[model samples]
Target: MDSAASEKSIIALDGWLKSPAGIYVREWEQACLDELTANIFGYNAVQVGMPQIDALAANRMPNKWQAATRMSNLDELALAAGNKQIAVALDFAELPFASQSLDLVVMPHVLEFAAEPHQVLREVERVLIPEGQVIICGFNPASLWGVRQGVRRITRSPYLPVAGEFISMPRMKDWLKLLNLGVTRSHFGCYAPPCRSTHWLNRFAFMENAGKRWWPYLGAVYMVHAVKRVKGMTLIGPAWNKKSASASQGVPATNRK
Candidate 1:
């Protein structure tokens, strides 16, 4: 709605992230990010949103930064960072960066929460270099968690920014394709039911592999990787048209004659 309302929603979201369910989500997401980002080669890498998730911890990129819409303390990020790194306040719809400057961008639960998710993806495409990798983490709308959220919709009292429009995999793939980003791969995780009790979560731990094998796309969350593509670019050597090119042909034999 308005900026004030958005800010309030964010606060509530941050609160849920500290709960048991949220902790479980963070653990799964952290592992997923580590696995996905470990082999990714890049110089400049950024993680937009999700301050609770240390998105770049597993990434070995030399220049790593976190961008957030808002945070408890601006200096908190820098202080936690041993060196000069810090989180920059950024609006997902509008990022301040030169075109094709970033080699990698990791978006952890930014789109589903955004008012205009399409614009955020557009901004992501704009900052990333050609062939740059972008890793996006989001809740799967066809999972147990989704079922819970759907039921909550019937009731007035929902949890953790339930108003967000959770996008599905096929829809996101289409969006990525439209942005000229090729789909690389995807990860499914957090298969356990959305239970707040740690005991119940542990009880359902076996569901992870079961979910992966039986209903892979139905995991509670998914991580998608895509690479940007720039078309119609080719290396140019010296023009060698035989009909017009006398320069490289026998040193102009007619002139010598």
Candidate 2:
């Protein structure tokens, strides 16, 4: 597709997000993000892409930013400013942050749409401080939705954005492992089949619980929380208390004698 067509599709997708299916996705993601970021204390945090959804709203970081490749319009920028969120327009593959500066970085459905997903991950690893955390949200290509999308593709109609290149969980894990980003916590959700109608989706609500127990890995969406692990770096703690050590060791050998 040409740039013009791609832009049009993106705009249509923006509309699609207001549909029942989109609302379902947003609700699940928002709840998961809230739980994941509520206790993540940090000085600097950023939510990259998807300005429409404030992924870091639950976080208490002193400095939180909304970073996107491009703002859909000036109103969006004004709204972000009104919300006291600093918004920056920049390329994901070339973030304009200093190395080891960010304590937290959240990417919401960014990698699939990015031109160079690997390079984007590299930038994330570069800007994060040691032990800093990164939360990633993505569409799983091993789910019922994936199967639906596959079938639709054969007939030239796609269930998801034509631009998205969904990545599987194992593949995403491998990418993070290569950058020494150790997976700490993760979740899978959205078990309902690919249905645009709200009523049908609600009918399958029971599958959410059932899928988690019977086929947890087959959920349509996944969230991954990883911490940057620096090689050969050891966290230092306060020195042992001399008095406590002496008490535990008892009196000196000569005194005891």
Task: For each candidate, give its TM-score against the true structure.
Answer: 0.85, 0.89
What TM-score, to 2 decimals, does candidate 1 have? 0.85
Off by over 4 Å in 2: 1-13, 80-84, 242-257
- Candidate 2 C-alpha lDDT tens digits along 100-119: 99999999887877767898
Worst 10 residues of 2 by lDDT: 1-10
lDDT for 226 in candidate 2 is: 99
Q: Candidate 2 clashing pairs?
A: none
Candidate 1 least-lDDT 10 residues: 80-89
